[model samples]
Target: MTEDNIAKHGKKGTFQISCFYVGEALCGIDIGFVQEINKQVLLTSVPHSPDYVVGIMNLRGKIVTIIDLGKKLGIESTANITDDTRIIIVNSKQEFIGFLVNKVTDVVVADRENVSPAPSNIKGVKGKFFQGVYKYKNKLVAILDVEEVLENE
Candidate 1:
């Protein structure tokens, strides 16, 4: 833990988070869960797939399913693809998947103590998809539960 975070949150054992934007809401996930971040990638649509599933893409020799995280969380669909848009690949339960976001923001270390239970609804997303909420730089970053997010798929 850095002296700054230690003094700020007054806790030990700080962990890093990969921050991103989903609509106007700021979100994050444990950096350890992230496999890679792609600026943009070509997608092949899946027929009769879940609404959240954007499509599928080939990463090297592997096929990765892409998800529109905003829609999945009920925030908002990623309307336009811009330079800021990013696809964050994560490995969960030995499966690799990608989460499409409005943008890739920053990476920061946060104290576990700073994480509080998620509200009933945040930016239209159900609290069940989040592990907790952490305050970062006077802003709230909802920490996403990758397992929960990918479950029942």
Candidate 2:
């Protein structure tokens, strides 16, 4: 990972990551890419869009495309929008996009060296979406490759 993609913590090689849940699996993204986490907002359905594209919403005057992250990642689809549902907004390519997650978790401080490569068992399209996996509190947090997840299929 490049310095620009991760936010350095006090230690030279450590960084903070925003963790969240997509179904039962824990996932995370580099804190550097996150703009904000927003609650469920009214979404205007977009016709002729991809299945993963939930819809679009106006976030403080800016139009943002919201994607069902779980579905995009080949995880369980986020079919219900509950109180725990959140939209993780990220500024990418000068545009703002939001990832709809099941719930917002904690910000984890992890060492760059500790992140293990995406497991060999996680093959096919899903494997390409992960940057690596970091062990946090006895659990594995799959780190997402934002660019890959945001890329059009």
Candidate 3:
């Protein structure tokens, strides 16, 4: 084997990313950064923030900025709840926030050798919110940047 090929494919890094479904897309989040997943809860709307900012919710007396991940991911928002929808509470930069997701999949270990970089061209800003792409089983899964998504929105 050539030196170049060895340098390119010789090493890999892995992380346990929690995968979830936001609308029709399957995505992932770094497990270490996530705190907990809260089921259906009450949310308070923030005045004049952004469309993606769903509202705020109280978690054990602590306030959390709730974000509609679908909207943040560039999909339409729905007020109604589905059996699949869930709230993922995360701590980013010491700030707490929650994201509404379609469904929670599983925690899988993804490696650098398996995860391809996020596509350069995209219609919206979600590309910057993704860490990389890895295929689990046979389907492509996007590892999301929780801090970037919440901070940007």
Candidate 4:
């Protein structure tokens, strides 16, 4: 373990990204930060908010804002929502936001070299929301920045 070896190898940047479905489209998030998966409940609609902000919901007496992942990510939302559809809650800089998802997919690990920067021109001006894009299986999934994606809302 010498400085030369460290310098030559570079630092590892691999992340264990968890794949989740928003309709047929595939998407991923770094699993290290996902807090828990809670199913839907009585969400109180917050009036005068952005379209992406669906509303607020109570979780064990604490209120949480639900962010529509499909709307926020510029993807066709998962329709015909069922009992399996869940709310994936994550924390970024101490703020908690819930993403309405169709279902939870298995988690997979990716290497540092496999991660690629998001393209400059993502359709619908949504390119900036992603932290990076990585491959899981043969399909490409965007890794979203939880904080940046929810900060404005």
Candidate 5:
């Protein structure tokens, strides 16, 4: 944990989080939920799936649903795959899924008490999709509610 984290979290229980970006917004997920992170993985589109479902990919014989994190959060699709674009593979409710993010930032320890309830609207993303929000480096990192995000529409 960095001194900044300690200063901001104020001695509360802290845990590490994997930070990433969705467009320009900073976001994070519990490191424990993340299985792996891949870059530019080949994806096959799924017909009749939700608009957020980018496609599916085979990961060592396991089929994982690929979700465009931006689209899932009501942001526009990532038009081009750049070097920074990545797929964060996470296990939610026993199902493996890949979330496409603009970039993977860093892992930082966050104080539990520092997490506050999500605002009704955050960078055009609905609050229900967020578990909470934390302040980091003068910016807010929205902590993704993985279970809520994986729930069927």
Candidate 6:
């Protein structure tokens, strides 16, 4: 991890991370960024939208753009929606966006010092999309860079 990232995500002592799966790879996001986690909701596909964009959903009167997290990260897309599928809603730049993940995992409290620089490639996901990797219970969780992931390709 860079000194700047360490200061940003680590200097705070420790922070909570919401872990989830995008295909077979494990991933996480800072809990502070998460608004809520919802079950598979009916999505209205947007014509001509980016391939990564699954669709939009009415989230309690609010419109949320749902993107397949796997596809966004160049991993396997979450094609088969099962009961385990979940939409992780996050507020970005005053707008709510949802990430469709394979399944929601556990919430972990990780020490900043434990976060390591991501490898050049993680299960086909580029390192640019990750802030770092946190290890927990013999598992490594790729920490998503929300801004990078949401950026227009």
Candidate that beats the other on lDDT, 1 or 6, i.e. the better one? 6
How do the residues 1-153 of candidate 5 rate in per-residue lDDT, one tens digit apiece?
Answer: 334434543455887789998988788997878999999568999999988888999999999999988988888676358988999999977889999998999998987777887788888889888777889998899988788888873
lDDT of 4: 0.71
TM-scores of the models, in the given order? Answer: 0.89, 0.88, 0.83, 0.80, 0.87, 0.95
The residue-level lDDT of candidate 3 at 86 comes to 83
**Residues 69-123, candidate 1, lDDT per residue (tens digit)?**
9888887887468888889999987888999999998998987866787787888
User: What lDDT tens digits, residue by residue, belong to model 2 across residues 14-91?
Assistant: 878899988887889989899999996579999999999999999889999999987887777874799999999998
lDDT, candidate 5, equals 0.84
Candidate 4 residue pairs that clash: none
| Per-residue C-alpha lDDT of model 4 across residues 64-121, encoded as one tens digit per residue | 8887788877776643468878788887767677898888887888775766776654
Error of 1 at 115 (Å): 1.0
Please rank every candidate by lDDT, starting with the best.
6, 1, 5, 2, 3, 4
Q: Provide the overall lDDT of each model, using Cα atoms, as 2-decimal numbers.
A: 0.85, 0.82, 0.75, 0.71, 0.84, 0.90
Worst lDDT run of 10 residues, candidate 6, spans 5-14
Model 1 residue 128 distance off true place after TM-score fit, in angstroms: 0.7
How many pairs of residues collide in model 5?
Answer: 0
Weakest lDDT window of 10 consecutive positions for candidate 5: 1-10
Query: How many angstroms is residue 90 displaced in model 6 relative to the true structure, after the best TM-score fit?
Result: 0.6
Residue pairs with backbone atoms closer than 3 Å in model 5 (clashes): none
Model 3 stretches with alpha carbons more than 4 Å out:
1-12, 121-125
Choose 1 or 4, whichever is better by lDDT.
1
The model with the greater TM-score, 4 or 6, is 6
Give the distance in Å from residue 111's predicted Cα in candidate 2 to where it truly belongs: 0.6
For all the candidates, what are their Cα RMSDs to the real structure?
A: 5.1, 3.5, 4.9, 5.2, 5.3, 1.3
What local lDDT does model 1 show for residue 12? 65
> In candidate 4, what residue range of length 10 has the lowest lDDT sum?
1-10
